[model samples]
Target: MSYVLAKSQNDDIHNAGECGGAVTSIFKYLLDEGLVDGVLAIKPGDDIYDGVPTFITDSDDLIGAAGSYHCAPTMVGNIIQKYLYDKKVAVTVKPCDMRSIDELIKRYKIKKENIYTIGLNCGGTVSPITGRKMIELYYDVDPDDVESEEIDKGQFIIELKDGTEKGVKIHDLEMEGYGRRNNCQRCDVKIPRNANIACGNWGSQDGWTFIEINDEKGQELIDGAKNAGILETKSPADPAVEGRLKVEGIMKKMASKVQSVKYPLVSEMDEWNRCIGCYACRDICPICWCCENCELNKDYFTLEENSSPDPLAFQGVRLSHMSFSCVDCGQCDDVCPMDIPVSLIFDKLQKKYYERTGYVAGVSDDVKPPLYSPEKTEL
Candidate 1:
């Protein structure tokens, strides 16, 4: 991997994007050069807190996708699988997004050659509704008046349209159940190294993005953007690199602590009693693409007349099918009507599987989960 500090050459992108406009500029370069047919990124929804994923075919639309929104918890993996599988696209991905994409690629749901992943270093994300409430309760500001939000140095910071900013300790907000999503709090993958290029503000100077080139494609992206006069780059200083690593280390430690406390054994959970047999978790799971022929749909597993099916039989069947491949993107948790920590058990199972096989789902391309492979015979 190679590390560098980069920024956009476009004045408007540099001024508007988060940290620097490297990401936006890269997308512009890709579109202008015909390297990709489209770009998928999050654009502002009704407000800063409401972010929606948008597909852009025109380079002019890249500006709308500039900046970061911590409240945008949408995943891009499924969108690529379901919509852009045949199209060449560039997308910005968080760790979870990259993980989901990797898992989908493994399942042949997405074509690896058709997509380019620009990875972002993520701390965590807050649901939009919870974010609005947190701004009102903790920041003492009207959620509607807020212009932007960020997570930095253990604080949840928000900037108002009036150019005023406020910050609250993340630990304090989380104690009151107002911080990041539970799965995010427990997520240890801070950097999306599985992508072609990973960019973030952690190690760079002000107004620049620290970029880690993970592969040949990432190097080509940087070189092409620079040659196209859309981006500028320089080597990062030693101190800045060290500081970034320190920040990543601290975030991982926090995640480990959260995981210990939040993920109880599946046998110990009682939230299953509230399940309404909605199957939302199964439907939302990125790895669960066998909806029509799912084992859970079989007559033996179905409750034709009852609203709630046996949790152990229903969720258990899913866990066995693809829990080892679960990326813990938390779509399941987010959609569950019963507010059950559905992803927790899946995440725990993946972790347990990792302990036994040294396999981390979606983190590396070289290793495959044992379930998908067959036994080898020796002569």
Candidate 2:
């Protein structure tokens, strides 16, 4: 995709209002102008423990849109399953989530004409809970001891109230490699080519968000923004944003280097042993799991109700059987109370399945999941 010169900017691209502030403002503007019935974006609340997806209609309801990233792609399916019949909603989603939407439409679950999609350019998102733990373990202090943390100067600075501090490169942290969802590593779709409108750090060189118009509807929205004086045209290259390009490049290279390293199934089993039979992995997976009653909970696997050790040679084998279908979203890893690396086990399995069968999950809506494909095809 070629870059276009648009709004002028000389400020740090990260601080650009459109990429962060303007996109959020536009959500409010749409609500005020009645352009969309409502907008769905991230809303911050008391649940610092877990981020909740919210459906908002009024401009007064928007919160924390600035923190949007590529975390929850499954919410699109949740919306389609629930609201596809009776609503025309504007939803903000990351590049991967938008791809899921495209897949949903092909499944006849959602209609393109009935929805407006705002694509956010991703700078990559980490599981805040996991990242926070990595920090606490590194510093060996109560997490509350951290007054503030800043990522700059090729390192992350952890500030303490005691007027003492330590610095670690963003890469030096263990959670850095674990930051991205596995599906995202195979993804190179930086911009949603199918989106009505797309914005992110990639569109503009300045700290400002680069807005791209992809369709007549998107252009109309841009016209409305321009007419309202909420927008302006600027060159793509702003020195402040350009200066950070090297840093972004370094992070991307590091991620790529890790991607090239081979992780095999033998290593995965060691990781899987950390799983204390907690089925949080199954609950967090966002794929085709259509079961009214899971066998894991039934007498089929359990020895007895509220009973402990197995009476026989077999303990339990449900996780081994079910984990093969996992999509490697890493939500399992993030949600585990025990802090088990279950997603790592699934990631290795997924890699093996992909290598042997050449099947990838959620790549296209039109394509049936590999397991459901014809037996002859597998043969």
Candidate 3:
């Protein structure tokens, strides 16, 4: 509903946080005021590439989750459904993340009033393994020596501890099949406005984050943070606003082109023949909540360990049931031990469903929703 160029007043937060720390400061404010019991966010686990989803119940621990993790491909909705339901929580959401959360809200699994969603503007995410290999192969730098990574100006840039940086064109990396995850490469949703507010470095200058407030809750977060003296705010210049829209527009065009390329169907592919029926994909899907009593577990469909799954009966049943709702998060693709591109399968299904019936995964409209597109200019 509004836009602001915001930064943190605290020097510590400004120095440590990504995009001037506005997001971290807001989380700190929420905790200090006891508005929420905890924060659900991502943090470095084994290293920068290993991002672990964590729940922070104290204000002091919030800063550990401050910076962005482009290499971390995680979904928090399933974590909430399995562990933190009924808790008053604040969480960070990417486009896919918010889409799954939106679906969950529709299902009445999580209450809107109890959760404050901070949407992160996402270009896309790199799988940790793929990222390391890419850096080694393309950047010609040791992946371990890299201290940070960022995607900007169509390049994947990595910074070293010595303060030196190297960049390689994303197109080049992706052309080599080494850049973002397969689902991310074609994902069209770049901003998660379903959250209270979306914050990122997309359109802001060096020391601030560009924010698009989407609702009253987002307004309250900004106003409350500023009133508490932890954050500073100013209206974004017209160019900065336009630049953000332009970036989203370019990304959508690329995604639409990628979407149009037809891949052979699951029935036609030999890849699905390798499925071990491990249920990893099904177990990891954030949208498939009925797994405990899933029909696939029935004796008729069950297969002995190491037996290949029936292409039509196993994956097909699941796809037909939930393909209309797939957000292309790629959690299924990420967990498949057989290395089958499950998300691609679901992506094709989602598009075909839309063609037959004019509804997106979460939206029931005849056309792609404007909220998910970069068509707005006045905001």
The numbered model that scores best in lDDT is 1
Put the candidates in lDDT order, highest first. 1, 3, 2
In candidate 2, position 116 carries an lDDT of: 80
lDDT of each: 0.87, 0.54, 0.83
Per-prediction RMSD in angstroms?
2.2, 6.4, 5.1
Task: Report the C-alpha displacement of residue 55, candidate 3, in angstroms.
Answer: 0.8
How would you encode candidate 3's per-residue C-alpha lDDT over 51-121 as one tens digit per residue? Answer: 89999988788778888898875679888877778899999999898888877776667777889999998
- When 1 and 3 are scored with lDDT, the better candidate is 1
Tell me the TM-score of model 1. Answer: 0.96
Single out the weakest 10-residue window by summed lDDT for candidate 2.
307-316
Q: Please, what are the lDDT tens digits per residue for candidate 1 over residues 30-56?
A: 999999999999999899988899999
Better of 1 and 2 by lDDT: 1
Q: Which structure among the candidates has the greatest TM-score? A: 1
